[model samples]
Target: MLENSNNTVLSEVDTFTNHYPRSSIKRITRYTTLEELHSLANKPLLSIGWLIICQDTAIKNSYLKFLEGLDQSNLVLFRITSEQKCSELLSALKADKVQYRIINNYKLKEEKVIDYVCKNLSITKVDAKYLCTRSGYYLPEVVKNVQTLKVLPKITKPIIRKYTEDRRSIAVYDLVNYLIGIGGKTTYEDCMQLVYEYRYGFEHLLKTTLAQITVYIKIYNLILDGELTLANCKIKKKDLQDKEISNLHDFRLYKIVESFDKISYDYLILLQLKLQQISPKFYSGVFDFVALLKINAKPGVEARVSTKINTKISSKVKEDLKTSEKRLDEFNRKRYTMTTDDCQKAFEYLKEQRDK
Candidate 1:
């Protein structure tokens, strides 16, 4: 099938026909009306079926309206992102009503990029390394950079470095650790450097941060409830399996539990709040995400965490804390029956006890 790069229809079809006169191909785009789609789908096929490329600028629920009752079995729209295959789309495809199967994005490995560069450009491993570094190991970026230097009489690491802008990337885990105050003392500038070094979209980083925070919060709650005791740095295997915390490695969990007291609970709560606020503004183009992190990580925030605790606790509040912990544990065990709002309320109840 001919790849749909642009909107020019007649010329591309002509070129395809000239190459393979026996085969027939038709292109359907996002702009194609429902009526037009039906007309095209119903047309007499010289071949088995038509391969249509639907390129929608803004994917929405309304697009599904175009295919509700269509009976085009041979039409296939395969090159789509995972996000586009919503629940509604899945249901249609599952019932065999929809003919197309949307596919997830495929990422290229570093080895593939290195092999391509070495074979096509006749460059050494050293030169290929420079290209990979400069392009941040992104397939499209690397291809674009190499194409610019392919016409040159000779290619070298220095020449590639000089010609292409440096977008060398950092490890995602390293940056996440720095942002969450795991290993080292980090400044706002340090966090920003890591953020800028990431080549993928900010959405991936945001999702990763949310997931990591969830893990930390679960561990924190376990410590508060005396389930994972900090004094002994040990937990029962059955407890881990029950709470779904078994995915964490043994040594890593031990380190986190040991250092849990060192990391301020207040700061983590502040960071989680800031992350939730900025999530809606992620695509607004107005908010600075790094600035939110900077504000949350301001000096003296961690100082709010006190090592000293009140020895005397009222019986009522103590009972309430136990009740909240029980509810949270239950929610963790049977999450399908409990919403995130329920978990938040339990946390707030625990917070009130801590304050008392």
Candidate 2:
């Protein structure tokens, strides 16, 4: 009960509070689509707590769209993720005259990764520490691989061990596989999907890995044919800037040329050098990237291209990728009725070649 201005005591239900109490009627949740966001905006908020916004841009945009659609008198409560994101959210909220709180972005440190796995994954501290310690400083990949590991039991998977052994190699392999899977023609979103879903066995995850393997195959073939030589193909540029190259809308080519950032084919060159140190036959040449790791390869490209394979091997990889996706879809429909035969055939081939 609350006292009115006239000094009369009355229950909240006796007034407009009956429609919306002094509390949030809707619980806290993540809004997946624009529809859900609008549904909440239509409701009245009795408290300063309702929506929870995370790091995903797609979902965050929807939340901002919802808030902007409301009037200034409307009450909007939301928490935006901090740490290298939420600029769009902030701008949208500002436009709508909304207010929000900025909390830590939940960044992963070296120890934090280990702790999360140990606590949430039901694994021993020793195992979790071992996993994080080996994956090095690539925190995002470490988190994803750890989450993938958490999905299964504590036993080590080959892919998980490979990820721990070298995240850069796994990243390059996935990047190359992703590029090849699209037949050297795709958008940035597709590239992100391959990198983000590399661990969870996205049906087409290994297509570019195989394509990368095949690119090496083509390089080796060229070397044997005397058509290309690493000595002649070596790129010579002083202080190449990767940040500038990242804007180059060609996923197929720039993924190899852009060396200014963490995710680039320049890392693949480094990986190739490391592989050659272990075994000469791994690449048999001083460079990978089709022995064409130069940025000035005639500025070659056309945007939003189709699946055009430079090699005959891509068709086979594409077929295998489709089959792997089918298996994943089947598993989704019936979790117990899944088999590793198609998956093993697609991935194990790359794994065997990756190690050898």
Query: Residue 320, candidate 2: how far off, in angstroms?
Result: 44
lDDT of 1 by residue, 190-223 (tens): 4554554442466667766766776677787777
What lDDT score belongs to each candidate, Candidate 1 first?
Answer: 0.53, 0.41
How well is each residue in 188-207 modelled by candidate 2, as lDDT tens digits?
Answer: 33343333335444323334
Give the best candidate by lDDT: 1
**Alpha-carbon runs more than 4 Å astray in model 2:** 1-85, 95-97, 104-107, 121-126, 133-288, 293-356
Which ranges of candidate 1 are over 4 A from the true structure? 1-23, 42-46, 57-73, 84-88, 95-105, 115-122, 171-176, 183-192, 195-265, 269-356
Kindly state the number of residue pairs that clash in model 2: 4
The global Cα lDDT (0 to 1) of model 2 is 0.41
The candidate 1 region of ten consecutive residues with least summed lDDT is 2-11
How high is the lDDT of residue 102 in model 1?
A: 37
